[model samples]
Target: MKQRHEVFFKQLEGMRNYLLKVADVTEEEAQIVPKGFKNNIRWNLGHVFVEQYAWIENLTKEEVDFPKHFNEWFGWGTSPDDFTAETPSLEELKPLLKEQIANIKGTYGDRLEEVFEPTQGMDTLEQVLLWTTFHEGMHLQTILDIKKVYECLIEN
Candidate 1:
């Protein structure tokens, strides 16, 4: 189990680096909804952080480390239209995503032996983190797609 956790930690480093690359967009670009997409780059970026925090904190029944009322803006079904307060800028979202990766690694790296029961077919913290890296990768791909569309918009 410890070795498995160690492997995922390295995988997470790749995720962290990919997310940072996805986040390199202007605030305006982040909010632009390309014609075929329902969400903007900004929304997807924040969603990644929201998911990591929600899965870990919810399962552990521990206090989440995100900003105040983050779920209101970034939860699974929440969207920019649902936001009642100011959301973080692209600049702000990037670092928060980066910080969450560090928090997860720092807090759990040595403790993967700690077991939590299966919820949604994930039987342990390591399983959740493992799945989350793939989840974040999907969103990073979405961000990249959005950027490609944004580029088309720019070229036009």
Candidate 2:
């Protein structure tokens, strides 16, 4: 992989690491839907995971491996209210989230510059990956906000 491409991957890994570290909440905490928030930490985490796969698949025009029911449980427009007992817990998602960066790097490291039919204004694999990083970063902030709200509620 080129140095520039590696930078994107590193940025992604760093953000993912920060997210996992910041989300040190218990499963119960992860599920808590703080007032004014439509989703919980668990939903944010799962959405990040599922969205990454969806973006990669769109760019590659091939199926990206992901856990089943991820779209239903965490895809765009999904809500925690829709989650069922079969929905994977935060524990189940952590490892998958950890593994996703490596999977993406290994699968697309050499194909970064490859152009595809434009999706979301991204015509290159590199562009899509960069977008995914930004998307994950946004959700990381949401997760942090959710955690803060719940923690404050507990303290009050």
* Model 2 whole-model lDDT (C-alpha atoms): 0.89
- Looking at model 1, report the run of 10 residues with the lowest lDDT sum: 109-118
Q: Return the TM-score for each candidate structure.
A: 0.89, 0.96
Cα RMSD (Å) per model?
1.9, 1.0
lDDT by residue (tens digit), candidate 2, 130-155: 88888888998998888788778779
lDDT of each: 0.79, 0.89
Model 1: pairs clashing at backbone N, Cα or C within 3 Å: none
